[model samples]
Target: MALITRGFGGRRRDDPNLPPGQYRTDDFPVLSAGPTPRISLDDWELAVVTESGERSTWSWAEFTALPADEPTVDIHCVTHWSKFGTRWRGVSLDTLLADVETAAEYVVAHSYGGYTTNIPLEDLLDGQAWVAYEFDGEPLVPAHGGPARLLVPHLYFWKSAKWLRALELRLDDEPGFWETAGYHNYGDPWREQRYQAD
Candidate 1:
């Protein structure tokens, strides 16, 4: 069954991609737990380190110069809003992790704002995730994770960390901000896994 959300200013979309307990919204909402940070391209970099100690870093220009992919994916937020057909262009995690070998089963995504989120490595590889810079064919604005953000569309929006800075592969699971704060560890919206109590 799908929700017919026709009340909030006529947001009547009924897409199957929407998760339960969520309403379809044509508008994008800004949901950040802390004040948004202002990061400059010159000061930004992405560092990827494997559990076995393989280290790689990419400057802003180098990151953008990698092969890019444009993916239009439906985004589901744990806060109960589902936005469909959202578009983004970025370098896939596959491209970044291509030469790196990791036996780690999980990953921790760190943000410039000191926020962190943990995810399974399997969820990020094989074209499942990206470091997106453009949204809707435009340079992503800072407020919405401009310069670059981790785009993990399969999970709740928060897992797609804004202002992404580093990725550390872990052999064991390490809980992140929300995960430690009672949000479900693995936020699969389809299962209505919003809170840990669920």
Candidate 2:
């Protein structure tokens, strides 16, 4: 039996800003591989581990103290939904990796509740990504990767890991949770890379 979802297979709006096969939606959908993690602000920390085993740790206060950037970007998901002009504020990856010494070319974002996702190092640099704590001028809620989440707008929303915890720099790319489960190793919505075959 084929299941039909409302507004999923309905009429298509002519929006050139949206990627191919994606429908623009005002609603921010909540999708997760597991239950939402309830991490306290006081207990939150972000770790950046270099390939050489060097580690830089930042408490919640220290992270929030860093310079932040406000970005209005379009986010696309693997499920064919695109949200445009979303406002976010957070510390850029350049700011985070500026002092960290590394020769790695890739990063695997580790998140709370054991969710993981891999992204190229270059994709995270040059103001391409951020560890976002606020959405739409308000503090993010747990259902939306609360304390902080990796915001990589260029790629599929899955690449923007939720509930970001630690980021491990790697010399070579390693497939993370979704990648290992038949999802594309690198999810680029523009390319429609959703499954392993993509």
Model 1 spans with C-alpha error above 4 angstroms: 1-14
TM-score of each: 0.92, 0.93
lDDT of each: 0.91, 0.93
Reference-based TM-score, model 1? 0.92
Q: Assess candidate 1 and give its lDDT.
A: 0.91
Clash tally, candidates in order: 0, 0
Model 2 agreement with the true structure over 1-198: per-residue lDDT tens digits: 987865544555345678888988999999988999999989999999999999999999999999999999999999889999999999999999999999999999999999999999999999999999999999988999988999999998999999999999999999999899999988888788899998
**In candidate 2, how many Å is residue 79 off?**
0.9
Number of the predicted model whose TM-score against the real structure is largest: 2
Q: Once superposed on the true structure, which residue ranges of model 2 sit more than 4 Å away at CA? A: 1-14
